[model samples]
Target chain A: MKLVPTIRYNVQDIITKTIPVYYGVFTLIFLTLFSMSKLTSLYMAGSFSGASFNSTVLIVVIGFVYTRSSFRYLTQMGVSKRTQITGKVISILLISAVAVVMDRLLELFAEFLFKSTEMTYEGSGIAFSLFDAYLSKLGPVAREMTLIGLGYTSRVMLLSATVFIAMLYVRMNTAAKVIVSVGIPVLAFVGMPALAMLIPEQMAKLIHTIAEITGLSNGLPIRSILWMTGGTVIFMMLYSLITRRAPIKD
Target chain B: MSSLELIGISKSFGNVKALDDINLTFEEGKIYGLLGRNGAGKTTMLKIIYEMLFPNSGAVHMDGHAIGGNDTALGKMFFIGEKNYFPEEMKVEKAFRLMNDFRKDFDPAYANRLADAFGLNIKKKIKSLSTGYASIFKNILALASNAPFILLDEPVLGLDANHRDMFYKFMIEKYSESPFTAIISTHLIEEVADVVEHVVIIRNGCIIRDEPRESLLDSGYSVSGKADTVRAFVSGREVLGTDALGGFETAYVLGECPKNDLPEGLEISRMDLQRLFIQLTNS
Candidate 1:
């Protein structure tokens, strides 16, 4: 009944599950790169970083996996469906922020290591943060703040969408589940390409219009941030609707 | 004192009606045995009460307010069913800790004590536990929950005889120390016949019997003797059921045995809960 406690408990649960996965992936990536650097004499010439993108993917997966498990467990513990959603929403926001900050810190650390080793290595060891690679035109402070906003909004939007998909899967029957599972890839890989081929000019115009609307065509990501924030709100509302009366399945 | 009431509740899965229009009330502090045969809607009713499954035509209420997924009303009850709702990787000790964090009344000391008594390894992940230990893990939480109401669906499933006995004993001890309502849904009727103060028997999605345990037991008596003798003695009476092996027989008859009429070579004893349940739900 205590809303704060329920939200706190869910946030704790999500973080408990997320920490190990996040760190494990980071460790794996670091070990692989270290091994490659020594064994194959691999050298990166330009900005070699996808921390934001990788972290976004990981957070999306964490969202999907925890939705079913947490919903069932919390409901069994007498937490209401509404409370569960509220808890999840807060957790998604908190985790997105944490992931962004952690990724930035790791990038700084990587840059430090690369700079120190640059004199000894044969090739120039340079690393650029995601913000510097994409938003070079902005001032330092503006770039950092915009990147943080972009990270949170994008991660929240994608994770909320993933959570919604997970809830939908839980609600689906076997036949419907099969249909959607097969339908999505077919639509993405085969159907869309065929349609685009049938109407090349129209499809090209549509893609261009969409890119412009989402602010991907422009260098400044301010409009994209607004788009992503709107997306987060929409996806979270859908997620809440699906979860409100969701039954605990056997 | 509080009461949980179900008013005209019904549920269906496709064409198969799981529960019909039914009304039941569970008071604040009595142990109830929700006995039914397999697929008799006992679990369905419990799920509905706990808000795990919504009823199609009715609502569940605590005191006077409807608890249509209300947090405060739901917080008053805990339902431990056969399903393992905990994350697979969670250890038993962490689960107890989380329960403590979730419920104000949750008693961690009691949970740890129960876990030790059951010889459950608190360090092991839930997925690593056997079926019986898993049941023990959940039951321990329910016992230590200290909520106003606890619903146990097949609480003793997969439990060995010794563990089953331990669970029943622990349940009684907990109930006596600080009374709370417990609706135990199980097929093992005889085991809980003495433990449960109230008896509710459901048959084909309908409640056929609801009364005090003593009155239900007093409704009938079992007479055992030669098959023919028992049959003759039970003639013209309401015979719930009868079982025979070789020449010997046991017949369950409605109403009390006539103490004065001592039929030769015949013996009468108290009704067997399992036998009564079998007969009542035989249809």
Candidate 2:
């Protein structure tokens, strides 16, 4: 199908589009925070205990904003929903991969070039580690990359699916749009706690199954692939169901 | 040949019924003027055909198959909607290229030529263009699209007199050379009266009149003279509407004109499309 090449092109477009927006916003934010931290370090010991940019969150937010703003425009240009779904999935994956690479490079540059120490906080205890510690402990570079790549890929896949699902209601009336925009996050946040309380036994059973399937190092890859595939199907169905008869509006 | 058939199409927004039981057919290679009053479901109908909005209860058929998620059917029809659906940041030239990419039949060269004729700067961002220029930008794309069917809703909106004239001329010129179906929904009935080959007059949410332009023009006429004479002449005929100026009266009548020429000062003239539209849709 033409979807293959169309998706390839859309992925390039999404990647091309994100770098400028992400870098521009992140640069301004990072510079402002860096200045504030340096000034604070004058009096206190350490304000910047290695700034851990939650780049996974960053990728998700980027996906959300892009899909929200561009879906109508893209569809109007004759891009089918199937192509859109496939393209977005590929784009989100590529974007997450790019972010991981950039993040790692920044970490290495900060450590080797600037001699900065990275820190891990275990509850109240703080432990220092070099940039190389992750690679050394994870195993061979190729295996470590597979595990880490799967982790990021799964996060991007789930997030992109979620963003697409939320955006499906964008053409609905103002009330529906608002409910979707505000309601989803509230539900997601509250649902976690609510689900735990409502179905303790079932939740424990599900966790046990997940744990059994994903035995830490040995099963992480399978778990990652499962989440990625599961998220894609679930969100695609949700989006198609709601938008099956949606009236396109400004 | 190709045609678009709307079978029992109906749409409603809340309690407001935008379209009701609209079953219409738009055939190939002719200009169709869809004349309707404001809020008469013109835009809604056009949007449904292009898949921008789905009808509440019925389907749009292209050729023989019902359209559903099939871009190929819609790809044959290009919708020139009133709203600017293109990305605000996209350049005008970029929009043309994108349209070309979507439809292989879209002529980028012809688009640029149309842009030049309209004096539009294709390099300018879509949002940066003035309202008139924005309409021109979209018009250029539609003109160059070369799709088998094109639905234009208020195509000349925001256009000045000169641009409007130019557009009409270009539309006719293009049609003569290479014929394509055009369903034009516009309030400016007089402007498109001579251009459209067929006429579809909609009132409220119902089809009031559907005929060829020649049949429509020949079907109705006006008789003006003294009030008494005009009334006597129009009596027993289908009076669409009447206008009075002091003692002078003119009655717009439908079907046919009286051939008897015995009246001393009674004057008869063909009812223009604009006047016919006004009377037919005047509630």
Candidate of highest lDDT: 1
After superposition, the stretches of candidate 1 with alpha carbons farther than 4 Å from their true spots are A13-17, A20-46, A51-53, A116-137, B223-236, B244-251, B256-268
Per-residue lDDT, model 2, residue A201, is 92
lDDT of candidates 1 onward, in order: 0.83, 0.73
lDDT of 1 at B274: 81
i-RMSD values for every candidate model: 1.2, 2.7
Q: Report the CAPRI category for model 1.
A: medium
lDDT of 1 by residue, A57-135 (tens): 6876777787788888888888888888888888788877777676666565555544633222211111123223466
In the predicted model 1, the residue pairs found to clash are: none
lDDT assessment of candidate 1? 0.83
TM-score of each: 0.90, 0.84
Candidate 2 chain B lDDT trough over 10 residues, lowest sum: B255-264
- Candidate 2 lDDT over residue span A69-122, tens digit each: 456665565555555656656666676777666555444433342232222211
- Show the colliding residue pairs in model 2: none
For each candidate, what's the DockQ?
A: 0.66, 0.39
In Å, residue B272's CA in model 2 sits off its true spot by 0.5
| For model 1 chain B, the run of ten residues with the poorest summed lDDT | B274-283
